[model samples]
Target chain A: MARRRGERVTRWLVGGPPGAFLLLFFLLPSLIMIVASFRYPGEFGGLAPLFPAGPGEEGGLTTENYRVFFSDWIYFQIFLKSFGVAAFTTLVCLLMAYPIALLIARSPHQRRDLMVLLVVLPFASNFLVRVYAWMIILGPFDLLFTRSAVILGLVYVHLPFMVLPLYTNLEKHDPVLLDAAQDLGATGWSRFWRVTFPLSLPGIFSGSALVFIPVLGVFAIPEILGGIHDWLVGNMIKEAFLGVRDWPFGSMLSLMLTVCVLAVAGAAAWLAARGLQRA
Target chain B: MRRAALAIEALAIGLLFWSFFSDARYALAGAALAALGAAAALGAFGQRRELPHFWLWFASILVYAFLYLPLAIVVIFSFNDSKLAAEWVGFTTSWYAKLLADVDMLAAARNSVLIALTASAVATVLGTMAGIAMHRYKPRLLPFMVLTPVAMPEILLGVSLLIFFLNTARPALALFGIEFDLGVLTVIIAHITFCIGFVAIIVRARLAGMDESIFEAARDLGATPWETFRRVTLPLIMPGVIAGALMAFTLSIDDFVITFFTSGVGTKTLPLEIYTMIKVAVTPEVNAVSTLLMLLTLGMIVVAGRVAPDVLRGK
Candidate 1:
């Protein structure tokens, strides 16, 4: 009985602080954000009081935020554009990372560690610096505030995330499979297409996830490198909260973004699981 | 075969580097280099039979060039003796000098270091406990709570925390007759919240690699759980904890978006400071600070990598 009590005390002692902290700091905030999405904007800024007003007064509770979101085609358009940019970023990252990750994975052991480090080295720099680096490169060409600039910036910032996961997945494949394909009179293109490419679908899925989800919420890239028309949902969210000071509207946008991201993550997990089942 | 690969690989890297400098100075030369590089790359791609995976190496070398050339420009132009970053007329250290003289930048750097130090220290303790708890006891909600912060979009956290801080602090503090708002302390707490996930992941990975018997042996020796952890487990996972701490330090100092939201008006981190400067104007002074920040981050992460190789591997 004494020892069991000691064990129970140890579990609580070990788990209680972080659990309490995350619940308060992370989980509570998320719940508040959800609640904020439903509350009306204050007369000045932020949300109005949490309680419903004396019947005739302004509504403290509202579906107006969500109504505003769905009633406007602009919000849907921004969401669509954000997804388009994310898909473009993910696709480009894969094209760039695939060969580099493949090569790093296939390299001899002693050299592999060094190559992996090299791949991640550029990514270690400050995020703004990486984005700012392109401003210098593109400024002379009149490309600084173009849509191309935003897409390029997004791709460059996220390239390492794609490489690391793809490399991790690619490194685990059996060499004999490739060798057998080669011995069976398969051409290099056919071998990769038929065998290697299919095998790396899992890597592609994970790398795409790492690249895609963050691009949806990215504000700084489009803010710096993009023109006025390059506004994604992120910029609108930033404008809503910071510039326009519409905290309720910002919460609604964030709630939508969170839902979209969770859906993408869920679908990716489901597809990945189904792919594994088929395999 | 190897010689052919090396020759073409060097040529590709050279052509890529050639455009980085000459583009602004001589657009013709830059175009020529680009055309020649593209032809050689295509030729290598079309003739993969002779070279034997030579295109792979060539493709990877070009990718590395793409990865690095922009960063190289940032570092190089920091010392460029020009007001604009277009052409490198000469080398000078004036930008670094200007950066050092700037009071706001220095204050921001001080705040960043202070926040990183405090947050990483606190996060390391909490994260280590979280790691150990999850590993040993396999608690239910703890893992979800710990890992979700790392996986979710950074802006979501930033936005939610902004709302939470704004809503909770004023009213909660008013009950005690104390006023609070978003600032340095809020930034620190936000940093700690996000950082705990990363540190926990690293520590858990470290714990995962060890044999279970060591802890069991300590427990079986008539020692209490805490006593066993002190003598056996702590010494064993010390490197991991240190690595986690270093990583958390770098991450906290490097973070921008979350800090941007939670920092409100007064608190200025290095990244936030850089954001304001970059927005106002493009200056070589920004480059100088960026180069120094890069060196600091690289230095700490390198040391951390040396201490625990798996830290680099993300294992």
Candidate 2:
């Protein structure tokens, strides 16, 4: 009994440092951000008292920052624009990825390997490089400054993320299932809709989530490829904190983005659960 | 039926060839011929039990072109010699030589190497610990803790860290009679913060796959917990730790968005340097630098693949 107790104690001692480290660094920074968001910025961007004073006070607990974001049409427009870009990017990636993924899944082994390498090679390069490559192709022809360019860049950057998962899921699907569907007198469309599409949903969901979440917070693509009108919420937050030095407002925006991302993720999880239940 | 399809496909191929080599009119003729041939082939093949294999082959080529053409252009242009930057100049190694001699590029390269090595090492240790603790202890806040760093957007994390330093740390350091400029140290800290999550996730995955009986067996053999961990568990998880470390290194070296937000005026990493150059225009010099970076990353990924192909093999 004593030996086992001593072993448990040793395990705790061995494991204690990591847990404490994460708590201090990861958890603590986020906690500080949340607290700072609620408080006002002090002299020269320092943290002021938690609650400053009443309306018109130099430093006070005010919901004005939050209210400004919510009440203003511009902030909402930026939010919508970011959402729209993410959605469009996701859709384009799905369109481009599905056919390629299908082809990869169906190809002979050597060819499939080559295709997979091609897909992963671009992905392994710096994300900025790939985006810059697009800028080169699109610029001087009035293409870089367009909204479509931003979407194209996003889709290009994320295509592998979408394709890899989809290809894996599709590759695992039994050929016999499709054969059986065809033998049952189903047409090509029916076979795809009934057999292939349903089996690929998990990959589709995961890929979309992976692409959508990051693209939502994409900072550089729009900044580089987009004109003045194409700035995302990410750019807005960056500008607020870095350019304008508005910490409270930036914090508020960050909090809003976090809430929105969680809400979308929750919705996705709920939808996925419903789908599994139906299945 | 097969003969007709083959004949039409050949005609289409001939037309495409002529279009590329001949005048605009011939090109148009070629495209029309190819389109008609393809349509007829699809129509005929659609009636058969098996869908046309030609469609698959054609689609595959198109997909490959889409994925590779841009990269091909960049790689090709990197060898160009003209200052025009757009038109294909004669191929030369001068740009590469220039890249070698560029002081700023070399400094950025050195900084990238330093940051990647230091950040990967620090993140590996911390991440391995976190992974083990999460696996062994099952802490109540583990999920939230892991998700906090992973889920928060890069911009948010960057700005938050910036705020944390400026608001909290800067003044406190001044009171200690030390003036700290946000330099290499700040960049390294940021890289470590982000890299930790990546390492933790990879290592955690490896830990999940590990059998619990090994540790139990070690205990049964009268080994102390530390001895068991040192002797048995460490060897088993070393691959995972190394894999995580490689990932952290790649992420740190490739990172631009976070580094941009946190790095000071003087601490220019390679990605940041390339980004600024790109903001002006796509120079052949930038392309040369990019090609080198791409080669390095590809080499690292190949090594990583050999080390842990299973991690990347599945979804």
Candidate 3:
């Protein structure tokens, strides 16, 4: 009984502060945002009050914001474009990162550590500054305000995300299997195809997810690199809240984005689970 | 095969070296180097039985160039005589001097450092306590709840926090007869919110690997629970705590989106200032500031790497 009481006290002391803070700050705000999404935008910009006086109230509660988003062809196109950019970035990053990861994985232990350190070092730098560097590199040409520029920036910023995970996965892989396959008359290409690539699928999935999700929601990269001509969902959300003051629309979009993100997350989890089960 | 591999290596390295001095028009030479290096590495690896893959070494070198190019450009331009980032007339440190003279830039940087320091300190305490409790108590579903912030998009978190401050926090504070507003305080709170997860995960990883027998040995020595914790547990996990604190500090300093949304009027952070600066024009002064920020960040990560290499390894 004493031990039980002690454990209870410990739990409260340990979990109470963080739990309460997140509940108040993180979870509660999200619930309020979701609720606000169902409401209408306030007149003259900004979010409307929750539980407004009546239907006549400016930006009162309504589902119209979501309806407008779903109905608008422009919004759909923007969403599609955002998805395309993210997918393209992930694909490019995967292709580029694989060789780096393989090279690092094959290095001596000390060199491997140094290589991984170098990869992570760039990521530790200011994200805005890195994108700014791209702006300088690509800006002189006519490439600054284009979708290609946006894709290039996305790939540049996110390549490390893909490489790190792939490297980790590759580093843990048993090299003896490759040798075994080689002894069994498997050629180099066939060895990778038959043995190495299959084992690295989990890393590929994780890297893709990591790259795709951030690229999907990235605002500054697109805004700064792609300029005003190319806007992703991140920019759309930013404009809705800060620029347009259409909180209702922003909320609706946020809700949709949350759903899309959750769907991607759920699918990844499902795939990982299936992979685990098979193993 | 050996001769071909060596030739590819030499060509790739030669192009990479030549690209630096050939001016901005030949910047594509860097890209060419990258491509040739990749192909050479592939070719060498495809025939590994005959000769070693020496060209793979050049491929790794080019990959480093790709990763470091932006930072290198920023640092290089900071010393350029011309105000334009692309042009390189002669080397000058005037931009660094200009950055030092800019009061607004200094003020923004001061604000960033202050907020990051306070946030990291608070997060370390909260996260360390939570880490200890979680290991000792093993609360159900709490770990998952804590990790939610790390998984969510920054924009979503920023937006939600903005709304929360406006709609929930302010109104609630008003009920208590206090005025509440968004500024440094709000940004700090948001930093702590996100930072707690990182600290907790890192500390927890350290705790998981700790030998439980040490704690028992303390207990057997008739040490009080607090004394055991102080002498044994605290010392054991000090590296993790420091690592987590460094990460939180670095993240908070580099953060822009969350800070942008949370910062009210007159609360500009460094990233916000840099963004505004770039949006107007890409001055050499901005390059100097960016280069400094990059150096500070890399320095911190290097220190953190030394303290807890495994923390960086994502173990």
Candidate 4:
């Protein structure tokens, strides 16, 4: 009985603080954001008040924020454009990541770590510095504030994300299978196309997801690199919260974005699992 | 195959020098650097035994070059003597001198250091507890709460936390919020919130590889739980704890977006200051500061890797 009490105390001592911190800092904020989305904007800005100040005061509750978001075509177009950019970026990251990931995986066993580190080294710098690197390079040739520049910045910052997952998946692949395919008179191209590519589907899916989701909500790359017309959902969300001080609308946009992200993550998890099972 | 590779190499060498002469200097320089890298890659791959195809070698080198050449350009341009120096007139360290002299930038750097040190210290403690708790106690909800923040888009956290701080610190923000350093504390909280997960992940990964029997042995040998942890688990996980601290510090210092959302008027971190500078003008001083920031983070990573290599691997 004493030992049981001790165990209980130990559990609380070890786990209680972080659990409480996350609840206050992470969980509560998320819940508040959800609730905030359903509320009305304040007179000056932000949300008016969720609870009544006095007895007769009406609560700040409404579906108008959602209604405004859904009824708007411009917002939908921007969301679509962001998704389109994310898809394109993911595709490009996959293509760029594959060659390096494959090479790293196929490298002489002792050299693999060094090769992987090389791939990750540049990314260790500040994120904005990496973005700024492109500004200097892209400033010339009239490409600084353009769609291609935004795409390029996204691809550069995110390439390592795609590469790491793809490399891990590729590294796990058995070389014996490749030798078996070759022993049966499979040409190099055919061997890769038939066996290697199919086996890497899980990696590709994951890499794509890793590249896709963040690009969807990134405001910085667009804010810094792209022209005025390239505002994504993130840029809009920022405008609502800080610029316009419309906390309700910002919460609404954030909630929608969170839902979209969770859905994509779920789909990726399902697809990756299926791919793993088949492989 | 050799002929084709050589043909590619000659073309690249030609372009590398040609781009230096071209009016659209930087863009062509990037292409030329990619080409030169591809050429060197061919020579290196040619000597390897039983490697991938020459085309693979060619393509992979170009990709690596793409990854690196822009930063190289930034570093190279920082030394150029002119403000809008399209061509290198002479090498100078004036930009670095200018960066040192900038008062606002210096203040931002100081604030960044203060925040990173405090946030990382707190995060390391919380994250270490969470790591040990999950490893030993196996709490289900703790893991999810710890990791979800790390996994979600940073902007989600930023905007949500903006609302959160505004609500929690409403009295302070109630007025104009001019004099209050509310954004600093809030940004610190925000940093710790996101950073805890990474530290936990690294610590947990470190713990996963240890021998479970050791903890059992310490327990059986009449060691109290606290004594066992201090004498055994703590020492073993020291590298991870240190690595986690360094990683958290680096992350806290470099963070911009979440900071951008949460920071008040007076709270200017280095990234925020650099951002405002970038918006104001594209100067070589920005390049100089960026080069320095890269060095700082890189040095930290090297130290982290020395203590705990797996932390560098995102484990």
Candidate 5:
């Protein structure tokens, strides 16, 4: 009985700090953001209580913030654009990364090491620097301030994120399966479609999720490389909260973005889980 | 095979020479290099038994060129004597001298170093503790708590923290007659908050690979829990802790989004400085700064790779 009590105490002590730290800083901040989203913005651009009277009040309880976002064509277009950019970036990253990842996985161990270093070195630098580099490359050729530039920047920024996971999965894959398919007179395309592609779906899904979520909230790239017309939901959030001092609407947009991210992450996690089971 | 190898090498050298003399036109040189690389790769595949060694060397050189060309340009242009940027008249070390003499740049560098060190240290301690806890205890809520910050967007976190600090703390602190600017402190806090997730993930990977029975054995041998941890677990996971700390340091230095939202007017990190410079005007000084920063980050990553290659290998 004494040992059991001591064990429980040790467990609690061990688990308490991280659990509480995360809850307080991460979970609590997000919860506050959610609650504040429903409140009104004060004159100083901070959140006011959702009670009797405030600066941004129309009566008491109101859905004005949500209504504003949903009704406005500009806001709706930004949301659509953000989603479209993230999806397209994910698609392009997967397409580009697949071949490179395959090549790395199939390479000798020493060469694989070199390839991995090449891929991750760019990742270690400041993201802003990488985007700035792209700005230099694209800005001169009149490629800056274009949707294609935004897409290119996103793809460049996220290619490694997609590649790493897919490479991880592919490295562990049994090459004999591919060999067996080939031995059975299967063509290269069919062998990949039937065997390799299916086997690597978990990595593909997780990589896509990783790429998609961050791309959605990436404000810097779109701000730097994109045209005024190519502004994303993140830009809108920044403009609303910081530029226009409209916390209520910004909070609403933030909450909506978080929800979208969560929904997508949940679906991806489910798909990855199913893929794991199949594997 | 030797002839093919020589041919590939000649092609690569010719393209590189063309890149230098071809008015710094990237697309043309890139196309030439790409064509040569493809040809060499095809030759390598066709000759399965005896691989063309020069082709391999050529491919390696091509990879390096592709990866380092932008950085090389940045470094080289920093020395251009002409102030009419991008027009190289001659080479001079004046840019480096100017960079050293700039007080604001020095201040930003100092602030960046301070924030990065503090955040990395705090995050490392917290993340190391968290990693040990999650690995040993297997608490039901561990996964959820760990994944929360990992999944949360930087924009949302930054905005939310801004709101919390400004609205909740500002008034309360004001009543207590305390004045605080949301500059370095806020940036450090934001960095630490996000960095905890990264450190936790890296350390968790290390902890997962550790043998739990080693700790059990230590306990069985009459070592106390703390003693067991200190003797058995800490040493085993020290590599991970170091790797996590290094990663956190790099991340804290590189972070811009969170810093942009949380930083005060006077608090400009190197990235912020470079960003403002780029927006105002592109100069060789900015390129010089970028080149230096890239080299620093590359050095850190290389050290990290040496210390914890397995961690980097995604094992």
Candidate 6:
């Protein structure tokens, strides 16, 4: 009984503060944004109060914010563009990162560790600084503030994301399988195609998802390198809240973005589940 | 087959060097550097019997060059004597001097440091406790709860926090006779909110790896829970905690999006200030500032890696 009481006290002492802090600051703000999405935009800027101004039977709730988002062809185009950019970035990252990850995974122990560190070393620097670095590199090519620049920046910034997961996954692959395949008189290419690639699909999917989701919300790179016209959903959301002062619209957009992210995660999880079952 | 492979490798390396010389005056120098690196890479490849693939080595070298090219450009331009950032007009240290003398930039740096220090300290404690609790208690919801901030887009979190402070937090604070404005305090709050998750993830990994027997031994030796935690648990996890704290500090100092949303008048952090500077023009001064910031963060990561190498690997 004493031990049970002690455990309860320790649990509360340990878990209580962080849980409450997250609830108040993290979760509550998200909840408020959701509530704000249901309201109208105020004149000039900001969100209108959720409650009606007058004391009557009139309700202030409206779906117009979401309606505006769904009805606009321009918004749809931007969303599609964002998705395309993210997909392209993911594809490019995967292609570029795969061989590098494999090389790192297969190298001598010390060299492999060093190569992995080299991949992660970039993260030690500021992301904005790295994007700024790209700005200088893209300057002479007449590519500054262009779509290509943004794509290039996204690939550069997110290469580690694709590489790390692929490395982790490839590291876990059994080397004995390769020997077995070769022992069966299979050539190197055939062995890899038959065994190695199939086993690394989970890693490929995960790395793609990792690169894709973040690339969808890449505002900094786009804003720095791609100019205003190349704005993604992330840039749009930022403009809505900070630039345009349209909180209701911003909140609605935020909700949609969250939904899109959730959908991506759900799909990835489903695919991973299926892949695991097949394996 | 060997000759064909060698031809392809030679052609690829020659094209790589040729492409560098296509644009800037420094391109030839860059090409020369690439040649030197290729030679080194070839030498290393020959020495390593385990690595049988030359094309793989070549491709990996190209990727490394790609990764470091921008950073190298930034560092090189910081020493450029000319006003044009992209051009190399002999080396000079004037930009670094100019960066040191900038008053407003210094203030922003100070603010960034203050915020990072305070936020990381608070986050480290909370995260360590939460990590311990999650590990020891096995709370069902803890994983999702901690990971939400990490998984959410920064802009989403920033805008949400912005809306909250403006609409809810300010009014709530005003009711208690405290003036609430979005400034340094709000930025710190926003930082801590996001930073907690990184710390929690690192600390949790460390906690999970901890030897269960040590704790059992402590208990058997008549050490009370608090005493055990104070000596055994804290010492065992100190490296993880320090690593977590260093990561939080680096992140808080370097954060831009969330800070941009949450900052009001006179609350420009280093990244925010750097963004403003870059938006105006690409000057050598900006490069100098960025180089300094990069050094600081790299130093912190080195320290963190020393404390616990696995912290970086998310082990």
The number of the candidate with the highest TM-score is: 1
- Candidate 6 lDDT by residue in tens digits, A39-106: 87877688766677788633377998878887889998988999999999999999899889988888
Model 1 regions more than 4 Å off: A52-55, B1-9, B12-16, B23-51
- Indicate the residue-level lDDT of B160 in model 6: 90
lDDT of 3 by residue, A117-138 (tens): 7888889888889888888777
Q: How far out, in Å, is residue B284 in model 4?
A: 1.2
| DockQ-based CAPRI category assigned to the predicted complex of candidate 2 | medium
Superposition error at A57 for model 2 (Å):
8.2
Candidate 3 runs further than 4 Å off: B1-24, B27-58
Put down candidate 1 lDDT per residue, A1-279, tens digits, no spaces. Answer: 999999899999998999999999999999999989998888888888888567766557789889988999989999999999999999999999999998988888888888888888888888999999999988877788999999999999999989998898889889999999999999889988988887887778888888899999999999999997679988988898998889989999999998999888887778767755654
**Deviation of model 4 at B18, angstroms:** 7.9
Query: Tens digits of per-residue lDDT for model 6 on B142-165?
Result: 666678888777888899999999
lDDT of 4 by residue, A1-90 (tens): 987899899999989999999999899989989999998777778777777688876556899988898998998898889889999999
DockQ of 3: 0.63
RMSD of each: 2.0, 4.0, 2.7, 3.3, 3.4, 3.6
Candidate 2 stretches greater than 4 Å from native: A1-15, A41-57, A106-115, A174-176, B1-57
Q: Please give the distance, in angstroms, between residue B253's alpha carbon in candidate 3 and its true position after superposition.
A: 0.3
Q: What are the per-residue Cα lDDT tens digits for candidate 4 across B137-212?
A: 9999999999988877899999888888776556545676654445679889999999999889888988999999
**For candidate 2, lDDT tens digit of each residue in B211-314?**
89988999898887778879998888888888889989998999887788778778999999988887775578988998899899989878977887655554
Which lDDT value does model 1 have at B301? 74
**Which candidate leads the pack in lDDT?**
1
Where does candidate 1 chain B have its weakest 10-residue lDDT segment? B23-32
Query: B94, model 6: CA deviation in Å?
Result: 0.8
- Per-residue lDDT of model 1, residues B1-315, tens digit only: 444545655664566555556745456546556654655655554654565666567678778878888998899999999998887789899999999999999999999999999999999999999999999899999998898888878998998899888888768988998889989899999999999998888888889999999888888888888789899999999999999999899889999999999998988989998898888887899899999999998898789788888778756
Provide fnat values for all models in the order shown.
Answer: 0.71, 0.50, 0.55, 0.61, 0.46, 0.59
**TM-score attained by model 3:** 0.93
lDDT of 1 at B68: 87
Error of 6 at A259 (Å): 0.6
Write out the backbone clash pairs for model 2.
Answer: A52-A60, A52-A61, A53-A60
lDDT of 4 at A183: 97
